[model samples]
Target: MSQQAADEKLELLQHTMMNWWVQEHFDYPWRDSSEPDWKRLITEVLLQRTNAAAVKRLYVDFFFKYPTAESLASAPVEEVEQAIHSLGLRWRAQYLPGLASNIADGVPDSSDELMKLPGVGPYVTGAFMVLHRNTSSTFVDANVVRLLGRYLGFEWDGETRRKKWLLDHVDALFSHGYTPSEFGYALLDFSREVCGRAPQCQSCEARTQCAYFATLEANNRALAQDNS
Candidate 1:
């Protein structure tokens, strides 16, 4: 695609994404700007390979019991495990205290130092940067990678989200009209809602413009002709 065409598509995506977020995005406590950095970071950890709805159900109560990183850090591993047992991944409960211990010192100002902490990785760091730090970064998880890869029609040999081309593309998209947090959240929600592993391509709002949808439609048409 030419530079001009890519810019136009990005603009349209930003407009469409922000609109969807305004109307359809799920509300999460961690997305709240007023939430403390520790809570936000912990929420990200909890969200990994766990459903957002499950996290939502226990978030307030979990935080109320612990309140701060220092409090969580001091809590027994067994207690922490029981606290988040409903979220599953019982093994993850063991790491909570160590993660909290690291954050009890304070959420590190530098991304490098922050990632050194337990359970903090690119997705978590990116979320912190865009949502809390008000910086431009792309928060990529499976949902995000699926969404962007399908919409933009990109391929990578390994870890699509971590690849420079994908990250740069997402960062560029976020640096434009929409705030990264808004766009990032929209990507996450939309991917889950409309563009899942078995995407609802026909019903998706961006069907006409989405590369994946177009490809699917074309394949369907060819199949129909062959059958006929």
Candidate 2:
């Protein structure tokens, strides 16, 4: 398909995605803007490398005590671990309070600045800025990796090339159609339910234009023809 056609299709897909998710999106407290920034940051942290379901209970309880950065900062290291026991990352959990101190307030703008805090990295920094800032920053999680991987049908595994391609798509999508927060949520929902770990190709709305699906279908046809 031509770039114009693909861009139009992408816009349509983005709209459909928001409609579906607004009705069905998971109701997590972190999603509530009324929730404190500290709470949101904590949720985002616990959410790193952890499933949402698993983080739910822990997030609620953790915020009860260390409600803000100051409280978290003053709280002992062992206390942080004790509260976040179920989170399964004792070491990283301990560092978040210190990280919060460094951030000073909400998520920092520069990735380098965010990284200066404990437990922050390029991936986490990108995620924070995009979801929180609405700055059209590109984000990549495993969901993004798989989403673009299947759709774009990347031939080369060059990490730089791969990252750039995905970032460009994300930037475009955020720029044209979606809010940073909602778009991130939609992408997360799509990746989990539609695209999935093994991928349920049949349920995907975007499958018609999905490079992975298209490539898979083409390959099947070729194989069938060869067998015949």
Candidate 3:
């Protein structure tokens, strides 16, 4: 597709996806804006390399024990580790304290400042800014990368060079009128449910415009023709 045509299609896809997300939004504890910033950050950290459903199970008890940055900062690292041990992150215990200490004063609004915290990489920093500070920043995690790569028909070899390309396109996609937090969550849910590792393209709202789906359809047609 031409660049102009692709951009227009992406706009339509975003609109369709946003509407679907509003109707079928997943209710996660961390998505609650009423929750404390420290709690959200903690949950995000626990969510890394861990199943979100599993993190949701431990969220309430985990926050009740360490509700604030100061509280988590003061807690013994071993105890912190124990609380999240089920998340399969043995080293997260060590990282949590430093993150808490950095945010003990206040959560930073800027990405640079946020990145200074332990475990506050690009994805976390972008998430924190959008969720906690209501800021516009581009942060691409594995899920976002995969979803966008397929949707946009970009062939990425999983190299650092491709990250910039992914982030740039993601930033453009989010540049539409969608609120950062809502759009972020929509992307998360869509990636998990519709556009997963093995995407459910048949039921996808944007399948008509999805580059990956087009490729799949073409391949299936070619295979059927060969068999005939």
Candidate 4:
């Protein structure tokens, strides 16, 4: 497809996804914008490689015990590890305190400074900017990559170079007036609820524009005709 045509389709997809999200967005502690910046940061880290449901179960209690960076930084690493042991990231106990210590003074506003903190990577940095600062930035995590790759028909072979293309497409999709935090959360929820590894294209709001869904529909129709 031409760049102009692709851009138009992406814009439509974004609109459809955002509209769906307005009605169906998941409720989670991390999505609460009123939460402290440090708490959001910690939640984002906990969410890495861990399911949101698991983190949700522990979020309130975890924060209640270690409510501030100073408290988390001062707590014994073992206790912190035990607190999050259910999340299954053993290293987070150490990493969390280190991250707390790094940001003890204040959470950094710049991406570079945020990345300097322990366990903060490109995705975390991008998430922080969107959730904490409400800034426009493209951060592609696994779910976002899968959704975009299938939607845009980009072949993802797990190459680092593909991230730039994915990020660019994600950035373009958010050109509409949606806030970065809302758009990012919408994409994440959409990926999980509809456009998953085995996508439920029949119920997807963006199925009309999704390349993967088109192919799946075509294949299913062909199979039905053969059986008929």
Candidate 5:
């Protein structure tokens, strides 16, 4: 398809997905814009490879124990580790103190400054900017790559999220009238619910414009015809 056509299709897909999200989307404490910046940034770090449900269970208690970055920064490393021990990334405990130490005053608004802190990278930084700073920025994790790749009929290797072309398209998603937080929330929830590893393609509102669903339907038709 032509580039213009592809762009139009993506806009339509984003619109459809956002509309569905408005009807229903996952709720998480970290998604609340009113949350302290430190809490928001810390939640994103804990959520790295951990499940959102797990994060939800621990979130309130975690904040209660270490109410501010200064409290966490001053706490013993062992206690910090114990607090998040259930999250399964014990190694992250080491960085948590340092990350909190740097942000004890407050989380930085600049992406470059945020990246300078321990354990913060592009994904975390982008998420902080979009969700907390209200910036029109985009970021992708593996789930995002998988969801967008399948929808657009694109292939992704482990490094696809870093590619400029793909990143450009991801940025374009906002041009369709999606607020950064809304789009971020919608994309994350939609990826988990509808376009997951084993997607529920049949019921997906965006399936009609989805390349993966089209391919799935074509293969299914071929198999049925062969059986007949």
Candidate 6:
């Protein structure tokens, strides 16, 4: 497709995805926009590579015990490990306290500085920077990647160029109004419920504009005609 055509298609996709997210994004304890920076960081640290359902079960008590960066910073490494024992990566939990402590002291102004921490990676650090500060930078976690894959009608064998292209599209689409946080959460929800691992094309809200769902439906109809 031409560049203009591709841009128009992506805009339509964004609008469709936004509506579903407005209604259905998960309301988790750690998702509160009002929460302090350290608190959010703690949740993200614990959530990394762990299941969301399992995190919901443990988040409250874990937060209650180690509520603040200062609290976790002073907390024993063993105690932090015990708190997030179910999430796995006990080593991550151990380093989390120190990371939180630095945030408590001073949240990093630059993405580069944020990535300098022990537990911070490109995705994790970028996510926190956008979510907390509402930066213009677009994010793509596992969920966003899945959503983009399905939306773009690709099997998505996890290629770097593919990921970059989608991220570039996101940046262009959200160049003005939408915050990166909102777009991130929307993609996260759409990937999980609407677009899904096994996409529900029939009931989906974005079937018209969704690259994957539209192609799938067209294929099904063609198959039916051939059988007829």
Q: Point out where model 4 deviates above 4 Å.
A: 1-5, 160-162
Which rank order by TM-score, best down to worst?
5, 4, 3, 6, 1, 2
- Pairs that collide in candidate 1 are none
Per-model TM against the reference: 0.83, 0.77, 0.89, 0.89, 0.92, 0.83
Clashes of 6: 0
Q: What is the C-alpha lDDT of each candidate?
A: 0.77, 0.69, 0.78, 0.81, 0.84, 0.72
Model 5, 220: alpha-carbon shift in Å?
0.8
lDDT string, candidate 1, 1-228, tens digits: 544455566666666666776788577888887888888888888987688889999998999999989999989999999999999987878878899888776687777787888777777787777777767766777777777677777654447777766766676567676666677777777767777778877656666677887888899999999999
lDDT of 6 at 198: 79
What is every candidate's alpha-carbon RMSD to the true fold? 2.9, 3.6, 2.2, 2.1, 1.8, 2.7
Model 4: per-residue lDDT, tens digit, 1-228? Answer: 555666888876788778878998488977776777788888889987677889999998999999888999888999999999999977878889888878777788999989988989887898888766888876666777777778878777566325555556767765768888788788778777777778877777788888988888899999999999
Cand. 4 TM to true fold: 0.89
The candidate, 3 or 6, that scores higher on lDDT is 3
User: Which structure is stronger by TM-score: 5 or 6?
Assistant: 5
Give the residue spans of candidate 1 off by over 4 A. 1-8, 155-158, 226-228
Per-prediction backbone clash count: 0, 0, 0, 0, 0, 0
Model 5 CA deviation exceeding 4 Å by range: 1-3
Write model 2 residue lDDT over 1-228, tens digit each, in one string.
444544665675566567667777587777777776555665677777677777887766777787778888787888788887786877876777787676546766676676676877666666677666555565666666666667655543446424555566655556655677777788777777777778878766677877888888999999999999
Q: What's the CA error at residue 70 for candidate 2, in Å?
A: 2.5
